[model samples]
Target: MTARVLLLGGTGDALAIARTLGPQHVYSLAGLGRVPADLACVVRVGGFGGAEGLARFLADEAVSLVFDATHPYAARISANAARACLAAQVPYWALRRAPWRAQAGDDWRMVSGWAGVVEAIAPFARPLFTLGREPLEHLNEVPEQQHWTVRCLEAHPGHARARIIDARGPFTAEGERALFTESRIDVVVSKNSGGAATEAKLAVARGMGLPVVMMQRPPLPDAQREFTSAQEVIGALDDYIKRSSNA
Candidate 1:
């Protein structure tokens, strides 16, 4: 029997990999989005409890390999995937996009994590937050005097000082420019989720000479192999299957 593959899904990279792998693989989403993307593979939504639950699921399903193409900032899920794959004795790989770097004319204040973001934006008012729904709670740490305009994939019950814009990405610089103008946004606060889908805002901020508080990506669990592109991951997965067959 052919080995079963499991893809920890959600990001554009995950969908691209699933499409390339066809319908034979299993794709799992965390169900955080209002509408999950349709994939060609077998789709599983919601979490598998935690690390223990994921290991049990992998055993029950006889999953031979796991591909983690989750969001860059999804530290907990990535950690769980690493632990579960190890416990289940399955081969695993992480597909991460290249991170964005500071460019000429970019006014970037690089910070390590969410706490750094809070501190970096302390004096700035009219902030545009693109850090997603999970970190919206942390906005409570910001002083009430600063008004925030948050843009995310889903609607979140944010602080009274925050105005939420529910939208998806593949955003363009022109559109982001309009948003920044309309919202009177003076600063942009975002995580370093590198990819073209949501990167236009950074360029727009830079063009407008707006200050950007960039939060660095969290550390990923050390995997045996890591890739930066969908094509590379596809090739690696094919090689992995070939090796499994020979074994």
Candidate 2:
């Protein structure tokens, strides 16, 4: 029997790896954002319930290897992938992009959780949040002294003191600067989701001399093999496919 691969993906890097997969491989998503229609591999949407369900799927589908190309902050799925792969006796590989580091003149305030974020931003009158939809949940709790500008994948009608900007990135530095200027953003709140796509905001914040409240990344389970780049993972997967075919 041919060795088939299972790819757990949601991030842009995951999509890059998924594009390289063939008919025997499967790309699984958690049913958020846009699903790609154009791929040689099968696309599976929704959750596998948890580790037990995922292990069952791996066995039922005869998946020989599992590649996790999820977002840096996606600790739960990453943990689940590790557990499921172990249970199914399959090799697990992961692609984690390097996180962005603070530079000179960058006023980065590292925070652990939502409470820490709230405390850090308390002094600022106008705060811009780029931490996905987490802020949306607390729209009702907006401080009387502050106005919030939230940017996420989906647009929502914000409350009196908050406005939502629905956007996708590789945001340009110039555009980010314009946004900060127009919104009069005193502070920026974000997660250390390291990638060029959203790194423009950090540069703009640095140039404007605005403080940034950064959320710490969660710890993830270790994979059998870990890659820093998608190209490296793709190369390794290709080598495995070739060797399996020859065997």
Candidate 3:
């Protein structure tokens, strides 16, 4: 039988890895919500309950390997994955995109957390905010903004009432600039998700003299190995699987 790999994936790179894995191994997403209709294999939506729950799940599924390709900000879930895999004595790998560096002319304001952004910058300008939409409690704290533009990869959950621009990216600097210009956005608030895909807002903010409240990514625990690109991730996964299976 093929090796059973529990892929904790929810980002762009995860999509690519899923494509690469194809039908060879049993695949699953330790995801945040209900399972997707188009997914290829099992999807363990939300958490594994916790480390104990996840450890039990891994044992029951007989998952041979674990790959965590979650968004860098999902540190808690990442930790849970690592812990569960460790309890099972299964090899695990972490693949993440590095954060973008602050550059010249960028009027970037850093915050410790995403909720901090919603708090600090909400009073400043009609902010463009939309990375995750679940914890929207902060938006209520600043209801007086001239406008609040939000975009999402998934359909609007009927949970927001802001200026909507439903789309996904690697957002383009040029398009983002146009968006800011059209909306007259004077400030931005976003999570430090890293990668060029989501960093367009930073470039646009720099060019436009607007300010940004950037929430810092949470600290990641030390890993057996960490990789930046897909190729390295693939090699590391293959090696870890070999060692784990043989052991």
Candidate 4:
């Protein structure tokens, strides 16, 4: 039988690879955003409990290989995948996108957590937060003097001190410039999620000479095989499936 593959995915790169998979392969998601209805592969939404549960799933499904293409910040899921694959004795591969590096004109401040973000943004009155829904949880804690503009996958009725924008990316530099100008964003709060889709904000920040409070990436477990690009994962998966079938 050909090797059955399990792809743990939530990012754009993961979705790209999922399009190449067949019905025998499984594409797993955390169900945070819109689930694709068009993929040829089996789409499994929600979680698998944890590493232990994932190991059982691998064994039950007889998955020969697993690919992890989750967001760069999704360290927990990646760690679970590594542990589960190890326990099941299945090949584990990860697609880790390269992070955005600071340009010459960019003023970037790295923060480890929410507290650090609060501290870093203390000096700015109008801050644009692109760090997702985490900021929504802290809306009650917003300072009386400052106003926050938050962007995430889903929009919510924002607090008096906060304004929320719900949108997806592949954003352009022109749009980002307009947003910054209209909001009077003095500083930007974001994660270093590298890719073209959301990168326009960084360039706009650079052009506007705005400081960015960047969240540091959490440490993730090392996979058996790690690739940086979607094409690399697809090529390897095809080769692995062929080898498994021939065996």
Quick one: ranking by TM-score, best first?
Answer: 4, 2, 1, 3
Q: Indicate the worst ten consecutive residues by lDDT in candidate 4.
A: 220-229
Q: Rate the local accuracy (lDDT) of all candidates.
A: 0.86, 0.93, 0.72, 0.93
Q: In model 1, where do residues sit more than 4 Å from their true spots?
A: 34-37, 138-142, 157-160, 239-247
**Residues 179-233, model 3: lDDT tens digits:** 9999788888778788767788888798889888777878875666778876778
| TM match of model 1 to true structure | 0.90
Candidate 1 least-lDDT 10 residues: 32-41
lDDT digits (tens) for residues 166-193 of candidate 4:
9998899999999999999999999999
C-alpha RMSD for every candidate: 2.2, 1.1, 3.1, 0.9
Q: Roughly what TM-score does model 2 have, to 2 decimal places?
A: 0.97
Identify the runs in model 2 with alpha carbons over 4 angstroms from their true place: none
Per-residue alpha-carbon lDDT of candidate 1 for residues 70-99, written as tens digits (9 for 90 to 100): 999999999999999999998778988899
- lDDT ranking, best first: 2, 4, 1, 3
Which of 1 and 2 is the better model by lDDT?
Answer: 2
Best by TM-score: 4
Q: How far in Å is the alpha carbon of 161 misplaced in model 1?
A: 2.5
lDDT of model number 1: 0.86
lDDT, candidate 3, residue 7? 79
